[model samples]
Target: MAPEVRTNVNLKPYRQALALPGLRPLLLVSVLARIPFTATSLALTFYVLLELERGYGAAGLVGAAMTVGAALGAPLLGRLVDRYGLRPVLALTTVAEAVFWSTAAVLPYPVLVGAAFLGGLLNLPLFSVIRQSIAAMAPPDQRRPAYALDSMSVELSFMIGPALAVALATSFSPHLTLYAVGAGIVGSGITLFLLNPPTRGSDEPTGPVGPPSRRAWLTPRLFGVLAVSTACTLVLGGTDVSVVAALRDGGEVRWTGLVLTVWAVASLVGGFAYGALTRPVPPWVLLAGLSLTTIPIGLGGGTWWLLCLALVPAGLLCAPTIAATADTVSRLAPVGARGEAMGLHGSAITVGVALGAPLAGAVIDHTVAGWGFAVTGLIGLLVALAVLPTELRRRRIAADHAAAERAAPEQTAGDDRKQSPTVGGPNGELVGTEH
Candidate 1:
């Protein structure tokens, strides 16, 4: 006789998710891998500024090249992963990362910018891969917690990676810092290549099945989720620039890291709590909350501590919103097309970040730094409002379709009862249907 398998009502969602086979290692590797990935942006910015003796504008250009390349490449790389297997795509990207980072320091400015673009084009699809794996590994019920965990990992990486990069770059030779960053990235890529986690669920087809047409899966609802995904990040990216501007204006620029760390901690806490909830919140609702919370942050920009305090509400919504978006995309996309869908999700993030900083910067340039927060938050709010109606309509349609499906079988049985005549016995008791 087997022992009773009792369910614990008090068991947390994270624990339940981690109990799944292979999830723990996958998430662990992802967090470790993302640290270097997060570090690259800041490291590159410093190298351009300190080593090349270039202006911020030149550094921005290099960063823009990489961002654009990443935005354009994400879907293409995901499609490659879908067409080819994960290992081949990983191998190709790993080699590309190795080559670019290894030679980046020695390249001239023009060459460096071009190389950066190419490097981004072939950049490892780590973000997409991890999300795809989570979707594949975790059942639908378990995905929210898994994605929440992933978002928290992201917050953790952001919290550590840039600060570490800044410390190394400022304290040591920028050249050596670049070398160290390159080494970390290469090492991460190799580790992922070895791990090679599943990108499709066991029930999903693993053999050669041509991916479905975009029209099949790229429904209006999915597009709305993607739009929300973009808006969510736009708010975040804008807030980052706005925070810096606000700090600088208040003559508290030196404490920027501390304030940002506070904001990240709030997000981390939010993600953890959201995962434990028995019911899931829609991404649009979370996005709206995030945007609304963000709009009022400018009111507290007078001091670094005040700014940190102001950021808490918005930060609290951040990881939850991000996790919700990832979960929604996994649900909406077909299993075969999940890789590309996740890639598009990454692209949306890149686009949002690219747009946010400049938009916020422009607002700051024209007005007070506090207004930058207000404007970006307003934009995010507007986007949320725009998408809400469409999302509702889609849900209504889906509900109606489901109701119709449910009613069909019952209606057919009723019609059959009406059409058939029953034979009666002498005592007026029903015996059988007419033959």
Candidate 2:
């Protein structure tokens, strides 16, 4: 008999992914956990600027310290999760976060910078953990929608978290605001510790199978995905700075929040639609489209609303591109090393954001704000172009290797048959003798 075909024709993709056990709670907790994580940077900036009475340059330095620490620490933390399991790593990071946030409000400038770096080193690996959990909870076929939902939740968090942080900082003392943000971060960590979502899928072994070496899973294809991820965030980060600069130049800086809100909403809508697609879109294609669309945004810098409208195309690609990258990483990484892979993905994101703001700021300093968009978009497009050939070559090699492997078995069977002696029976039936 032929194999049976099972189809979920009536179920929506998001619904199907959500229907899986543990996924809903996991996603909910992830969103909640990420809100404080998102707020930390803004809150720290406010504290440095308002409470410490420092210049923007000093604030930028503090932020840079944290960014550098996170970039360096993410992969190491991920490796720890892979080896020691989730709870221990979470606990350790949680304690570290608690210590930093509790004392951050009182530290001197130099001390705070060092503390920020240390705090970032042990920063709760919320992004990686959430992604790793999604990969664990959702099957390969269902992962796109799951990751899409994850991306949307991230957008939602960013929309809410920084705004809330800013509000508290403005309304209350920056010192009090820092305490509240700290409380939120510590709370998120504690919650994650208690929840302890699975990092490996059901099909994947629970116990240590001994993770493969880095070279085994970190292929050129994986690097390409990471590069695309970095490029995507670089564009986003530059766009952020450019938007503010453009608005300030137009004397409509007050409308900055509205424009950004529109952009975020567009991304949410795009993520929703992308999740429902029957087939996956490649990350490279999405990145290229994002870059292409982003390049024209500067043309609309004449007005805030025009900029908002111009941002729609690139915004639409944001969540989908991110979701696609996460999905690709999950597919590429070995189960044993997925935590590390996701961590590296997080590092790529951090590096991109770190680079984007400065690069865009430098451009906006020397040239017009509009050129910020043009230059950043051009860089992203160039990167996408550069990575395309490598990705294609990798796919071709993988295909050839798969085909050769498939052919080997058939070839061996044919050789065995040919080597066997054949005889004609009395009834004219042919019989083959085994060697």
Clash counts per candidate, in order, are: 0, 0
Q: Write the per-residue lDDT of candidate 1 for residues 211-244, one digit (tens) a residue.
A: 8899999987788788888988999999999999
Task: Evaluate residue 18 in candidate 2 and report its C-alpha lDDT on the 0 to 100 scale.
Answer: 97
Tens-place lDDT per residue, model 2, 1-435, is 999998654348888999998999988998887888788888989999988899999999999999999998999999999988999999999899889989998889999999999988998999999999999999999999999999999999999999999999999878988889889888988988888899998888886667789999998889989999999999999999999999999999999999999999999989988898899998988999999999889999759999999999999999999999999999999998999999999999999999988899999999999888888898889988988998789779899999999999999999887776789988999988777
lDDT of every model, 2 decimals: 0.90, 0.91
Q: Where does candidate 2 stray beyond 4 Å? A: 1-11, 398-435
RMSD to the true structure for each prediction, in A, is 5.1, 5.4
User: What does candidate 2 score in Cα RMSD to the true structure?
Assistant: 5.4
Worst 10 residues of 2 by lDDT: 6-15
In candidate 2 the C-alpha lDDT for residue 322 amounts to: 95
